[model samples]
Target: MDRQPRQSPDFLEALSARSQDIFRRLVERYLETGDPVGSRALSKMLDMQLSPASVRNVMADLEELGLIAAPHTSAGRAPTQEGLRFFVDAMLEVGTMDETERDQIARTVSGGARGGRVEDLLNEASALLSGLSHGAGMVIAAKSDMMLKHVEFVRLDPERAMAILVGQDGQVENRIIDLPPGLTASALTQASNFLARHIVGKTLKEARQSIRRQSERQRAELDEIAQRLVESGLASMIEAETSTPTLIVRGRANLIDDAMASDDLARVRQLFDEIETQKGLLELLDDAETAQGVRIFIGSENKLFSLSGSSVVLSPYKDANDKVIGILGVIGPTRLNYARIVPVVDYTAHVVSRLISKKGEL
Candidate 1:
């Protein structure tokens, strides 16, 4: 379970100049119109000296190069996944966002900062993203350090006690730890005093390390019962936080538009189902945005999306300390305009990082 994403393959010298031109046209046309590309149409658009028959020959050659496919006998060709990959990797030219779009995105993403909580910011960002992209937008909020605000212990049973930990950031965690065999109310008081002395103003890891060192010193008057309680309680608290997955997604309904009209309707339904079930969207984004940067998963190359005929453009958003907090991205049909959306997603992630930093400063 190495969590890092697999690296992308290096580009090889494969398609010739003419074949590249044909592939680019088919990909561009498919993305723009969501339709197949006929050779006659391409010949007229490119103003090449080739007839329909000659253009068809070149298209066949391009198909042999794994760059194009004819969906039916009489229909025009469409860019295959391999062809789309080639275009995305080398040929596609992304147009710059107009000033209007840039300002709009900035305003939209920053709207959730009224109170400046990370959760609120992420929710606003997800909703704004969905609105902007006309597809699903997702944000995986990263867990931050808990600044301790308070702690209390409740005796749930003679053999169990619950540690209620509250953080300055307004998050709460409750962990149940087994009581020592001979533990009593007096022992609980002594344990709370001993533990609070070590836990306050320190992170869970820091507290654990400090407690471990203190217990190992084995002072003669040390409260053995209290030390064991603190140790078990700390371990349980850490495990509880790690096991909880926090993810936010919006705009799934946006996918049911005309762009997804392929023979894979059932498959699309399954993909939507997966998105709503397990944290599939987060998992896919986590797997792709590996280098602390943006990554594009096109068509069959992404296992989660193989049957869905979809593409995911993901970017890693960082926290104030410059650590990758989570990933953000758009998911849509494979014919999506990767050229346009890649830069948009990348810029959006950057904006999110900047906004988080600003909010932290506040």
Candidate 2:
């Protein structure tokens, strides 16, 4: 469906206490087992004090109300999408991350160093989250929108030099190129001088493109040696494709486990397919930029996640300037323990924001 049908709270207000209890149990069981729950099973386990016949009748009533689904010819029932929504909004008990978990997450996200780079913080955060969540963890690096601080070139030979990038926010990246074939150290130095004269204050794409046009028009105006270095250096820079945001994902293998039954293996395979498409993954997180605290997109609530039967819990991390630099979160089955994982995801995002802010501090 392109959009989820809007559900009114009135349906919840109309449920009796016993019906609500039964609905909660069925949803919980489905989440834990990924199977339809039968009325006899509920009464046998929970001491619900209701006969199987009465429970079955109640299940029928719930099915009629659109809170549960009964697969054809099955005595058991599963929660419909509306049923999961009701459980999340009214029945689920939200929990908080304990102090110990928070402390560890804090250390890992901040890199435990007073002045570590933003890249370090994000890398560590991704690892820590994946290990803890036992699901795929993800982070998008801070965007490059800062003023240029400094630029330097390290000459390797007559033909090759390495461009060392330094951002105003303390991020660093390196671009290296082969020497055009036989230029002199003097020619390389001359090319560096040319770049310094034009490149110190612009973004990498801006600098590379501008340098290419300059070199193209005036190749004959400069010595052949300087011309070769400039041509090679700018060519190497263009090949870098450095403008796209960096995506870090870890622990994808954890998605398959004994918890997933043999018949459900197809779903696991589908999930891996989704992972290979980063554009879809980015779209899934786009709402994070506008969310306050933790945002949960349940199965099929989002198109990108529909086929995977997965849910994403994400929070946006901001830079020192209060602009959102990136997002941090986990992706797992819809059966995830939302009550517990929600706090973990929310708090980790907060820790990441603080670390990013510290790294970006002027």
C-alpha TM-score for every candidate: 0.78, 0.74
Instruction: List ranges where model 1 is wrong by over 4 Å.
Output: 1-16, 72-74, 151-165, 172-201, 210-229, 243-245, 257-260, 273-292
Candidate 2 clashing pairs? 159-179, 160-179
Angstrom error at residue 53, model 1: 1.9
The lDDT for every candidate, in the order shown, is: 0.71, 0.71
Question: lDDT winner among the candidates?
Answer: 1
Span of 10 residues, lowest total lDDT, candidate 1: 1-10
Q: Write the per-residue lDDT of candidate 1 for residues 1-362, one digit (tens) a residue.
A: 01123343333366566666766777788898878989889887774577878778889888777678887784799887777776777776766788888787788778866665667777877887777677788776555566555666788989988888776656676778778788878778776766666677766777778777764565334477776777777787777655544677788777876435555567668677666564454465355445555677877776766767778777788768877777878888878776677678877887788998876642
Once model 2 is optimally superposed onto the true structure by TM-score, how far is the C-alpha of residue 361 displaced, in angstroms?
3.5
Candidate 2 lDDT over 193-271, as tens digits, reads 7766666777656776776666445545557767766666766665563345677877777777722643566776776
